[model samples]
Target: MKKLIYSIAVITAVIQFYSCQKLDIAPISKFTEANYWTDIDKAKLMLNMGYNQMYSAGIMWRDEFLSDNMVHTYGTSDQNSIRRGEATASLNLFANEWKDAYGGIKTCLVFLANVDRVPGMPEATKNRMIDEIRFIRAYLYFRLVNYYGDVPFFTTEISLDDAYKIKRTPKNEILAFIHSELDDIMNRGNLPRAENLVAEEKGRITIGAACAFQARAYLYEGNYQKVKEYAGYLINDPSKYGAYQLFQYPAKKEESYFMLFTPENEYNNEVILDITYVPNLKYWTNMSQMAPISKNAEISADNPTQELVDCYLTMNGLPVKGTGKDPAYNENDPYVNRDPRLSATVVYDNYKWQNKNGSVDVIRTAAGTNTSDSYKGPVERQTKTGYYVHKYYDWTMTPNNQSGLNIIMFRFADVLLMYAEACNELGKITQQEWDTTIRPIRERAGFKVAAALDYPAAKSQGEIRDVIRNERRVELALEGLRWYDVKRWKIGQEVLNGTMHGFRFSGAGGDTDGGYVRVNQYKFNDNRDYLWSVPLTQMDLNQNLKPNNPGY
Candidate 1:
């Protein structure tokens, strides 16, 4: 298979900043004039630029640190302020997010404006490209509206007259537009499935990706029917989705599912859509700094919170401390006989790190050891919560920490979880529904056959909902979905409040975090923290975006 490699020149975004006083009669550069869009190839190049412009590696990894999943150890990261409840209207992170999203929309609009000018291209390919632009535009709007509630909506490059005068469009309206856009494309677009794409087109938009994004948009709307409809299409009609089953190959039981994160498995059957990275072309993130067994070049960040650790169900499919309906759990050896995902997701006390040789490096998170390998002793940048994210570690990194690991943005496992959630919400979840969705995900995570993955005959809807939700958290841990899920479920007030705990470390007083060595108290201001403050600069540029997200 060919890798999606973008060695082409990056297109200058068509939407110039509002600060620019005047538009030049013509673009001084060759990239902007009629020469560029005269033919098929350059137009495709413009499309590729939109793809590159929209993606953010930070969203894939570091955003998880903002949620309860991981705490910022260094406190210098952008999300640190937001995590501490001190986020303001001028926070650059939120502002940049707004700019990038709208800028992406701008890029797509530019492409759509000129796509009709490209001549002598195959109709199928050209139509597919247009469909992709539609999907990308919808996706950007989805992110924008979700993050900041109301946003300036536009389908075309903003003219000077409309520029500063454009008012905020409600989030619901944006979502409705997204649904219609997705509907038209899915019904009429000649989009390929994951399996249908050539290696060079591996990262191109697909029907499955469109459906996945549409389903997610509806999930945010709390429209269970739309969620079930779209997700069920992908789940039931496997051929249409290129047969996206959970990647369950026969391998070592502990590590079979772990291979999903490896570069070797790029664009596999289960991958719905992934942001592709090509070495020396468009390199992706090097998580070696954050997820490594050592602090060689950089200190680790986003240390997995203990609360996240406890979310993984026991091997017998019970909580660490059993709930009202679930069986009692083993507190003494909570990590043992638990979900196989625990071993795959977190670097726990005494977790194994495979060396290039057949030897293994054991991770010991005990607090008081002087050993360099210990989480608290010799290392200055060890896991803050006594655990590190083991997923997406990119074991194949070069000595200097260069890696080309493509971030899997959407996978079939998420589709299954969505279906399960919608099913439960719609009061239609049954043993059969479990078999199709949640059961397979848990089973792939190393649940024993006929064990916890087995359908429960009599569980309340609330109990079933929690099981599905927790299943989502455990299965998608460290993938950056937990942050959105916490917000979407409106449980951030409950989850993000109080003292966040790390592993039980044997330590006395006099530390920066005080006697409670691993506790970091996070504040979630439920009254207004849900919707991020719109960037102050955006308002300064265009007051039409004013009355910023209430309480900004």
Candidate 2:
């Protein structure tokens, strides 16, 4: 079992500063503010609480709904509302995310304020813990600025009254602060490297994690130079930060890509950062909502779309559309002759699903075998897109589908992709860089053809840009990163304003768009949909929060 050592009870201190008549009567049994910060363990417990609030598996999975990657079967979902261009200032999704991010920030602030008060803690340990808390704070702030631009930003714990009166700060200022903090943490050298982490410290932050975040931060800022600089720190010299590589299963090389998510592969070298979960201790139910109904999934609310499915390249590393279109693509057998990752990530028509009893079951989504009804029937608890998410499903999970698999936040493959994008954007992508990044990724995904593994020497920069973006999409599909990519790339209107499709059910279909199931029609106002509206409830709580995002 992969244990998150920081899974301890949180110790809260209610400091009473003003006592009526100066009564010196100290409580004998209860822990007070004066007595709480005396032990190092208590400080660890406080930091543990911050770790618990850092990231959530459920929220990560739900974020996929914001992009074209996945769709919610229920029309009333918050994500669906946003997809339909009907988002309001009162949307609970906005308010809840805001609340959660701030809640995590507050935990980090509280830890930083009192951690020094703990007695007998080693200086090295203290500094490392401080860096860890700083990373958490930066991560939460990044989440805030990414969702709600110009959010109320603070470094220290504030009074409830002050929180109510605080005004929103410019998002650029917050981004600069995040970059600065991460830089300082990396330079300070307080955090351990990924390779140096003991079993007890498996899920803690490392220098590589900081570098990865810095690269991601620069990517969002569109500073390709800085992106290259930060990402190169890990790509150029892994020994200094941490050693990382694309994980490959020697015994079953064909299934290497799919095996990366199995519980047995948790904390692999490819994983720089992950949300740790131990069986029967800390697990998630999000898979229950996305898994196939035939696998005893509970809700089946989210499903993969044809837009994402079509993004996968054919076996010869050719697109299904445009000038680079694969000549051998068969509409009648769309899934065949495609990249191996297509089968690894998605359960499409005629997919071979593995069973617990060492059996293989063919999932025919269009014909409704080993799955819910076909897309034409439109049943509740069925995949409306005629596809199911196959990645990250723990087959060993109980019937309830509660899984202990750690959700990867930062992985080496993402670093490679970021580096490749930065190089391409800077017009400096050499074959050497291609070999270092994209080629290895495709090779590890079972690609053997020279066309799939070799760099495109003839393609223009714009065509190469498309290649890198598509590579990132198929490589990181259903991993909760597509929404950020769509936003940062500013392609929302181009991709989000069309009717999404499903499997080609030629005959028995009442609503078919050119023989394909019409899943849903979406709208995206590029003007307002880029930034979410500040929740109306938050605006009511603080008058300084007026003037929500443009279209709300």
Candidate 3:
């Protein structure tokens, strides 16, 4: 549980940029460049450090706050700025992404540069470690390119002189390198396939993880062919992608899909890669506190948006027909007959959560629904958006909930969803394709009704594309992929630019927009907000990263 931390130790006197901090400090005095990497265990420790830093801090929640999934009430300045069309460059390493990603990339470069020095290890073990570092490096750059369009790119360790002279590389070129790097790791490197890995190495990258990330990167580039190829690699063959299958409905569990997020089901086949944590160690995460229940006496930050709630399909696999539409939905019984995922991912009125003792803690958000109890919605410390996030809440660690629950970065269900999207984009989609992927997801979500489980017939690419996208939203809700999705789809202007809304706490509902609260107006300046600008201080340090991205 003891984490080893390191710095890249580059000798530089020039003004430091966020991406290029003094690469020479050993956070722990026990290890330094002179004595470190002298043994296999030491080298492995550094590699482990890379995994620790790879997606630390805000990377998990950035997708939700930066996109339309959550209505931010209290959080970081970056979250507020990104939502308000005013992301400044001062928040760099990534403006909206924060400083941790570049730090992670720096850690990888340091490890890749010195890992070979370690002796007494089998060549296979060393190569596997190197492969893992390569994957982390590629993944970090993947994040960089997604946020800052064309960032200064480098693979090897560089002096400040060379660093200052380096200009931003084209994003497509870096993306291509990310793809090739992942491909090399999966095809050429000796990383154990997911099915072959031991319990201790459960969260590490495997061929399936590499493939899933590659498909995701290609998806960003609009490379439908490559997306289809990589996703299909995982979808068409289970053995090839770690024998992944949906977590089936458990009779005793409150909800079938919720089981996947519980500690008892950690590292199930459905998960491709997860940012892991350990209890009573440096790895235990406080993310659970961000989405605390009303009575838990924790900070309430991430409130689920009404926009996201409506994204789920009705039980009939059709849009929730609002009043005046065919087969109009009744507002009084809004949660009934809805997509099963709605109850799984969100904590709404009357949500049944679990306790460590396996008892159900019914969450009553309505006013008078819990008049005698201290825990009720629309009260102080309650969610501003009328809903709370429950997707990754660790019930066992509640109250003093510093959870060891791993935050999933990529999973097989995402690959299937990606495959469905890619196939639809390529004009090769069919009802059978939906049945293969989307149907199973809903069915495993406890949707036994034929209307919700059956695939739709005879739809064009555009229609199915929406279906696939919405399916992705509901299936992966609150897992922090929504921002990237909106960016890649080029729909930020449409989704993030309106008046955000939620439920009426006063029981005054009459119309669709009635009794709702206006949270904030999310402004998206299509001219520049899509790709954030580099830090102004960084640009000032090195003029090479010139012309801050558009409106900045």
Candidate 4:
């Protein structure tokens, strides 16, 4: 993918407060007197650029892409090369995101600071823009503190020299700052409903997005009441403020979950805020880069682990409770009753396989299915994970194979889970809570909410909480929330660290060794691994900054 650049130049006889040679270039920037804040159109353009930055090298891919969404444990070569993957400090992106996140926050700040300069800009428009920027500013900083511990806070633009001298603040102080900014946005009535935007403006943030983010913020801090308050508003009147529909199974199972991320459905009611993907938009989505190779094409570097497959609940929406007595389980009843989300998420055995060409192609599901021993005609493209990611695969997107899909950053389903989580933590819910709160999601997923689990069951807080967590993991898999969910709940060891297994394949003149692969499931050997190690360079640049997490 080619690199995309975003900059706003302001001409001035600026003294060197920082060592930023990049900012010292000649006067092509529109921030000058004749163009910039000189008018409303200029201001609108500038503000739009800031938001557009998010879809570029900003928060869209780099920041959220490599996070806990998908676990990558490819060949030994890839694993050994990443220190962060092996739970060490030498990892590349981990050490760099500290600066990357700050760079984005800095850009957002500059846009906000300069908004007033545009002449003839209506007060209402100006205030709305400011509110949006403030929300972004808070969101970026929140991620910084969460991922990198403590780092510099940039409320204003700085030169390279002054930038190096900035010191990290205490974590609490950073949190307080985030709270102040969010509180202001919430009180200001700046955000509009998600449905208000036209087709061209669909991916922009909405009022529900801001409040949903606030609910997450409170969740991280263990502020149950705040989470409940914000999420409650969403649950009671989801149609009015939020947007998300329960999962609808497409005709072909592979297309079932893919609808969520397909470019055609990017602005669907389910998605609140998404990272837009325009094939002609001059930006690169890592989808093609991450997809597996086929008989006639090159495979993606990214591979899924067996652990991820096992995370899928049975057809009945319950964990596949294995029986230790039998080494070989019964295959006759494979699809009997399991978690509904499981089938929608994973392409496992006996299920239909719609070839990339939209034809009902017969693909092997039994053991010894590899054709590495044979030539590359039809069998070469079989998955390495034994199962494939069905969530983002588009049947209509075949021939050209250009993934013009928008990745959802926030959705109404997530809001529902957040509300359920808060309600569970709040002790108990009223009779209305079960019907109005949780049942909608159950009906969407084709699950029969047990009578005891439904409202009037008087279920305990812990029981309801468990149900909510399971629902989220099943429904949101591969959308990119799994790893973070495990870490925040401090269940990495239980969820990640273990021996991963898959079905053994054998047939069609194919023969292979072991044919069985064992991979690492998430688990914590050290407490410090819960939080990512702060980038090593960040600590060296500023002694005042806190050390990488606690253990590093």
| Native-structure RMSD, model 1 | 3.6
* Global lDDT scores for all candidate models: 0.73, 0.82, 0.70, 0.55
Cα lDDT tens digits for candidate 3, 298-340: 6666678778887877766667644323265566657777877
For each candidate, give its TM-score against the true structure. Answer: 0.92, 0.94, 0.89, 0.80
Q: Worst lDDT window (10 residues) for model 4? A: 10-19
Weakest 10 consecutive residues of candidate 2 by summed lDDT = 19-28
Which residue pairs overlap in candidate 3's backbone? 8-23, 9-23, 9-24, 10-23
From the highest TM-score down, the ranking of the candidates is 2, 1, 3, 4
Model 2, 1-552: lDDT tens per residue? 144332433232222221111111110111225566888766777677667777868778878889999888754799999998989998989888887777667667767877878889999999999999999999988988889889888897555566568888999999999999999999999998999998888888999999999999999889999999988999878878999989988778888898898887889989999988766667787777777777877766788888899999888888887786899998888988899898889988788887656699887677535346344455666677788888998877777877878889999999999999999999958999999999999999988898999988988889889889999999999888999999999999888998987777555365778777777889999899989989888788778877788999
Q: Cα RMSD for candidate 3?
A: 4.6
Clashing pairs in 2: none
**Count of steric clashes across candidates, in order:** 3, 0, 4, 32
User: What shift in Å separates residue 131 of candidate 4 from its native position after superposition?
Assistant: 1.6
Could you say which candidate leads in TM-score? 2
Residue pairs with backbone overlap in model 1: 2-199, 315-337, 315-338
Question: Native-vs-model 2 lDDT?
Answer: 0.82
